[model samples]
Target chain A: MVENYNDVKTINTFEIKERSYFSILWGRFKKNKMAVISLYFIIFLIVVAIVGPLVSPYHYTMMDYTALYQTPNAKHWMGTDDGGRDLATLIVYGLRNALIVGFGAGLVEVFIGILIGAIAGYLGGQVDNILMRFVDIMFALPSFLLNLVLVVVLGRSLFTILLAIGLTSWAGMARLVRGQVLTVKQLEYIEAAKALGASNLTIILRYVIPNSVGPIAVALSFNIPGAMMMESGLSLIGLGVMPPMPSWGGLISQGSRWMLSYPHMILFPAGAFALTILAFTFFGDGLRDAFDPKTE
Target chain B: MAQNILQVENVKKYFKVGKKDLKAVDGVSFALEKHKSLGIVGESGSGKSTLARLILGLIPPTEGDVYLLGKSIFKASKNEVKQLRREIQMVFQNPYLSLFPHMTIGSNIEEPLRLHNIGTKKTRKSIVLNLMEQVGVPPQYYNSFPHELSGGQQQRVAIARALALEPQLIVFDEPVSSLDVSIQAQILNLLLELKRKTDLSYIFIAHDLAVVEYVSDLIAVMYLGVFVEFASTEELLNEPLHPYTQTLLKSVPVIGGEIRDITISGEIPSPINPPSGCPFHPRCPYKKEICEIEKPILKEVKPEHNVACHLY
Candidate 1:
């Protein structure tokens, strides 16, 4: 170990560079080749969602009566749905909406989870008891049933679906964060931070959150896909985003009607949906492995 | 007279374990003067670490108060408490655990300075580098995480961190216990050198008698949440009044000396249900009749020496 240290010292004689936590995490994340590919694919999907509409041959709502039900022909790639809408354009818009809902709900869960978890874990006693009990109640509620009730009550809309999924999904996140916080808070450095005169907020934000990032990152990676799946499930039940505004779930649901007769209808959207889900799942699994504190 | 930098006034911390209350640091009181060092030596369950936390105001004492430069830390308001933290700092026991895993060694040392808004970015960097140098850590390790460094190097970083605030008193809780014997000496020597070069006082807690004697001017022998003996290091080592202290001193392995076949028999009594009186009486070799029924308070037996035993 001593010899290794000296060797590194000699190699970097004059250039003293600071390696960030993210850089190190990225380095670890890159080790898993599939995860790297999935990350790139997810990024590519996001990019497509952003610009695919502007560059596509037809608008998502544009219907070509003459070229209706065509499959993968030149100029009309990915065919057309039953409504004669360009399936490629529809899928682009669907990907955009799916990404939004997935990322939006994931952000909500992370924000709320870190807040409640850090508070309950750091401030033990009555505050902990009350907050954790509330979390327990949240846990006890049937998440799917609650999501269903919320979607019905709020009336089907993009924002409502995101909110419902976010609200229902955060309980697990809160519990996970709280557990992480509990363990990290007990570490000696936290007390050392306290002794060094860091405020409660500083300790929570700077010390606590950074240390607990591993688990939280893993949880968030899974939550994005989980949110997407929940939104898709809602759309599958016919109460997702309204028509015109294409969502991946709504597109797949619309396609499933012509199951045997027009396999093309289900084939395109379903394949995209499954691929995206698989990408996120693989990415999340890779993240879980990367951030597994035991590895390092 | 020397200034009293820190004072713990009968500070008691009780933790509820199931039905009974675990008296972790029951009515432990001591005063550390500026530029002086007080070593607290004890076994694992003796609450030495708990007492260190109470002194640092990391945890509030269930009863009594800890004073920093004559101001009570527990009673201080939120802002005032923060201000007091600048005057007191602590180096935790485990070197590996004392540093943030994510941050670089340089950043770890600079954190206390950053938290207090002590200097500009440029100045903080220079201060961190200077501190790293002072603690004998290599400046090239500035960007290295805690895991990359050896245990001794990590401890140096931790010490550098504690020193950044320039606190008057730093409480070291078994800072060298986790290091190898050779590394322990190096760290201890660094601490001694630092102590010599500064006006900083210390509350050094350790289980090792030799290490405590090497670094401390005054030493307190703790047993089951209370001090059984307190005196100057020389006085305590030369003429230990309490039987427990005597056993502890005799047990320290000596070079080229007879190996005394002496050990404290039986387990330390549970803090939740401590012995009725003289917490060490059950394991003490020289226990009197009065030692079992009534508890003895720390009373001065000799000039500047205190013992909490009936025999004293």
Candidate 2:
């Protein structure tokens, strides 16, 4: 690329390429082989989360007295825990909860973060000072501990877990969005907007926000897995969704009780969490490459 | 005579530096007739660009007023200020950083139209295409990023973006000063062509006298924070009244002229703590007791020409 631009200064840009934004983004995204592979892995995780439980042979909740603490077999692929619940079935049922909390927290946090940070960055006065101070305060606290306290206060449920993670998780995105807006608001297009009779709000939302989507996209993709892992960590530690509702964390917590005897119970759920986080992180890396053409 | 399109009435801008107020623009005033270009020439710290910023309302004044179409820009309400913005725009020096890197060339051009709500989306598309055409950008390049274009093309797009609103006055603040010599000539020619086709007015600011003379209808020589001389380009070049303006012309590299470019001896003073009376006194070889003690007012030396110096 350096070699390509070396003459560099004198290129006839008159008949430049017909590269649309989306096409360029898509083209760059396709170039990252690792990210594409991770994206497929994430899609597979999504598929399992929504449909895995229905196809499980044994019921996730129903206890079979005859096959208590049973080892791996044709009926129960991942073997049974001390309660005789199908380990494979439990992993299957846990997917729905994992995806919901991950996606919900990710979406809500990014939305609030982008809105607040964009406003704060573009306004850049008393509002930026106050809001960013609050963000700094929240940022200093341990997110996991915050979730633990929230679950205790709100009564540990899947919904509360989602809300807690969503509320505390926006700090990263807010900072990212604010940084992006700080750089983007100074752009000539923004001044052009002001010079064209555009109101402050119009300048902010139309010019500032849309132009700032790249960083927000990167921040969103990066934070989703962190939210999911947080939810699972909370559940694993008994501060997350209660025993009856299946979660990767709940399964891991249940499996840890009999870790010596039934290792398969804990291993599968923990493995799922690890892989999902890795996939999302890789996807985020790919997206950054795709969205930012300056890398080209 | 052309109706006055812009009248800058003793504009002063003071910013805090260290502890004292650093006067960026100190009582600078000039009037530009309609469709006429004013070339503001000065050294780096002479406040030429700041005066252009003052005229464009990029920053507000501390102790004076700027009138556009004969109305106070400072006292105007938000709606009034915004409406005034539609008629004037500015282009910056660094073409590389001027454009939003993420947006397509077309959308960047269309941005001003969207801001004014001038027409529907379809109308904006056509306007952008026409503007791009006028600026010598092909239809294919509309969707490209700023990085893809050469420095000259980017400035052309910046030109296209400036022309988006059909503004009457476009301020070029060292617009070509950042580019190479070849690209600089290209951008200068483009601005001249634009003025010819659109009948637009310009406030051209530069550190060099030669470039300013080429594109200017009038030239205002700025020293420290004031215009030392303001006259038609031909008159100012032929008979620069202010000693500092003459020093500037003397400094210009000449091919066959008898006056050596090695004439001017001293540098411009820092604007923060300028000279005691006249900002040009220390640099003026003909400095006297009165020149060191008394600041001169801009006096009309010839018809439609003014100079601020003790001799004048």
**Candidate 1 per-residue C-alpha lDDT over A1-296 given as tens digits, one digit per residue, 9 for 90 to 100:** 99999998976863466687777777778888899999999999999998998888789778778887778878878888777889989988989889999999998889888889888888988998999999999999998899999999998889988988898888888888889889988888888888888777888889889878888888888779889888888888877888788888888888888868778888999899889988998898788877775555
- Local accuracy by lDDT, each model: 0.88, 0.83
Model 2 ranges with Cα > 4 A deviation: A1-18, A54-59, A70-72, A187-189, A291-294, B257-261
Model 1's DockQ?
0.68
**Which pairs clash inside model 1?**
none
* Model 2 C-alpha lDDT per residue in residues A50-129, reported as the tens digit of each score: 77766766676788888887878888777887778887778877777888888899888988898889888988999999
lDDT of each residue in B135-165, candidate 2, tens digit only:
8888878778888789889988988988888
Per-prediction TM-score: 0.95, 0.92
